[model samples]
Target chain A: GAGVSQSPSNKVTEKGKDVELRCDPISGHTALYWYRQSLGQGLEFLIYFQGNSAPDKSGLPSDRFSAERTGGSVSTLTIQRTQQEDSAVYLCASSLRDSSQPQHFGDGTRLSIL
Target chain B: QQQVKQSPQSLIVQKGGIPIINCAYENTAFDYFPWYQQFPGKGPALLIAIRPDVSEKKEGRFTISFNKSAKQFSLHIMDSQPGDSATYFCAAIKGGSYIPTFGRGTSLIVHP
Candidate 1:
């Protein structure tokens, strides 16, 4: 079975540009999460989606960051007006509906804002 | 507030040695603890996990020693090898929340 996967294994863009990162969760996984790992830093929570219900966007840093999960499978994270501070590896993970289950992670998309 | 705190940013051990990574959490609600391993250019994978009800769990050469009252936990790797070199993360979850709070990762290197 295919695990979670992200698009554009690597991406580079200029400051003030917008970047959209995509994630495809494992089959039948109803829970999906997005996280950011900066250099020498821990994983920072971003947004999470469970089924068709409202997402938990509490972890989103600011209004410029947003995400949407469509049809309960694919998710896209959009960072508007990217800044050098946005340079980090964006990770996506998925798990079964239960909270106790282990999460499966994707290789992540490394975004470099120059 | 960061719920979980991990220490010893990195560790180096010789082959056949024991390597231990520790983590502490401030949240008492956390009942499930898990450890994840990540290699270069790869995603994190679950290594071992334990719930509050269990004091310890051992799977092959990996063992998780959990202390529920102290809110502290540790992962012990026996007979460490170079292949075990990677970043390790400790995570915990509270109640029914699906998202788990992760700790500052620890990079472990085993030398032969």
Candidate 2:
């Protein structure tokens, strides 16, 4: 894709249900990131992946949130036992290699937990 | 902890007026500062960026003024327009760090 692509632009689920959000980063880009945006809170870094390096999961809120990148291209974020507080816009971005380069973002998936 | 702190959670400016949003950071290790603009249903797009070495950077109607000594940066929108109304976020990235620390954001409303 010419730019970062995200699947299921919008998702609505009941509390306690699990949800999986997908992101397809730009081709040739080696770095990928996930963030969450809510009303009060700004963009919160959730995870990061660069090549074969170990992803930085330090930002993940809890064990219920997990993400994995496959083939160094597409990535998926899974939220287990979702809570109402999980409602937010999940954004995905890809950069050339690291923070030195600008990150291109997707339209994002708006997750609503009811 | 929030490394970057943004002020004026919300602002209302008349069209053609200049709207300035400010941000401050505590980490001296931060080398890159970038501003992002986001619409209601879209993801944030990079507006402009500045490095600590440079005191200022300008692109079109957007300008970034940096003060390395004070650890502060601000975004100035010249001749603001209604279309420019969006949520603005300021971010700081430290050297060798892949993740950026973003501010809480400011909701700018350009009134016609």
Question: Any residue pairs clashing in model 2, and if so which?
Answer: none
Which candidate achieves the best DockQ against the true structure?
2
CAPRI grade of model 1: medium
Q: Which stretches of candidate 2 lie over 4 Å from their true place?
A: none
For each of the candidates, give the backbone clash count.
0, 0
Per-prediction RMSD in angstroms? 1.0, 0.9
Minimum summed lDDT over a 10-residue window in model 1 chain B is located at: B95-104
Docking class of 2: high
Error of 1 at A18 (Å): 0.3
Interface RMSD, Å, model 1: 1.2
Model 2, span A4-104: residue lDDT tens:
99989999999999999999999999999999998867899999999999999998999999999999999999999999999999999999999789999
lDDT of 2 by residue, B47-106 (tens): 899999899999999999999989999999999999999999999988988789999999
- Top candidate by lDDT: 2
At residue B98, give the lDDT of candidate 2: 77
Off by over 4 Å in 1: none
| Pairs of residues at least 3 apart in sequence or in different chains that clash in candidate 1 | none
**TM-score of every model versus the real structure:** 0.98, 0.97
